[model samples]
Target: MAKEIERKFLVRSDEWRTRAVSSAKLMQAYITVNEDRNVRVRLIDGTSARLTIKVGKSAMVRDEFEYEIPVQDAEELTSSAIGIVIEKVRHRVPIAGKTFEIDVYEGFYSGLVVAEVELESEEDHFERPSWLGEEVTGDRRYSNMMLATNDLASELIHGVSHQAL
Candidate 1:
């Protein structure tokens, strides 16, 4: 099983935009979300699709299993997803030998922008770009799974502040 170790942050500025090497539109939905595991289906650029299963309890690391699937199947699964489908454009920006995935959200999450960097190890150190905002690595509210299932208004009303950074 492959392990994924990553850190998440809110975007502070648009400086990373011009430095991005590429961007792709993505739509993903969770088929199942539980405390221990989650099953997700993602359609990328309306052409490629993947089915991903993530297991583990830690926010910083998880055992991830991902496989390519037929676009038709992904589309079907997305339609029957449990909650809101995630829509975003992912921009790939490279800095200091690491790549950061900046997601510009769309649909109900239009104004949210988040950046994530994968690390080889949980203790690995990485450069923090000036555009990176507050670290939200362990914040469940910023997790894509939670973002997909909960109402954004409730999140804000309940005091989960998305502060300007």
Candidate 2:
């Protein structure tokens, strides 16, 4: 069994932008591999794909399992998804000695910027950048999987102009 433990935080400022290296801009289609539990696959950088399975009894510690798969397989599974499509550009930024993934969303939910940090363990401590805001680690709305099912741009943030610098 693979366990993925990580902490999520909101971006606090645009400082991280200048430091971020543009990774890739890709269109992703997702489906509910297990909607009841929160398991899904994300295809990034065109051909690279990852299957993320999150399981946990509480919000603090979640067992996340990520596996690499073929993008074609992942695309085929998108048909199994309940509904909705998500689009975003992934950026890699090094902050606080850790690599943070900053997702700048587009398409239906544009102007939404979300930053996520994966930890070795749930209790692992990390340097929180000033640009990081409220912690939405446990919020399902911020989860990439749920983001596919719910158009939460309006729900996560009212209206903001999100762009990569």
Candidate 3:
């Protein structure tokens, strides 16, 4: 099984922009989202797409399976997604041998920026950049599945600040 282990954080500054190696426009939506698992369809750069299934009850780790799918199918799935579709620009910033995915949200989630880094293991060590803010690794409100289902107001009430930067 494929295990995904990552840490999440709110972006506090724009310093990461300077170090960004590349960026991709991403649109994703959940097909099914529940406490136990999530099924997501993601289109990247309007060219490629992926269908991902993640299962597990833990916030820090999950069993992930991803498959490349036709962009047309992905687009169709996105339009029929369960709730709000997620729109964001992901910038790949490499720092201290680790690449951080800094996502700047758009649309209904404008002004929210998050940074995430996948680790080799749960115990892997990594350096935190100055632009990274409070750790939200285990915060369910920050989870993409929850973000797709809830609005800004609901997220704020759950401790996700609009003034994150």
User: Which candidate number would show the highest lDDT if scored against the true structure?
Assistant: 1
| Better candidate by lDDT, 2 or 3 | 3
Return the number of clashes found in candidate 1: 0
Give a tens-digit lDDT track for model 1, residues 26-61: 999999999989999999999999999999989999
> Model 1 TM-score?
0.93
Q: How far off is residue 58 in model 1, in Å? A: 0.6
TM-score of each prediction: 0.93, 0.80, 0.93
Better of 1 and 3 by lDDT: 1
Error of 2 at 32 (Å): 2.4
Model 2, runs deviating above 4 Å = 26-28, 33-36, 162-165
Residue-level lDDT of model 2, residues 1-165, one tens digit each, is: 766566676665677878886678756555543644666766776778877777765544666677888888888766576556667888888876888888877787676777888777767888887777778888867776667776676777674544232
Ranking by TM-score: 1, 3, 2
Residue 119 error, candidate 3, Å:
0.4
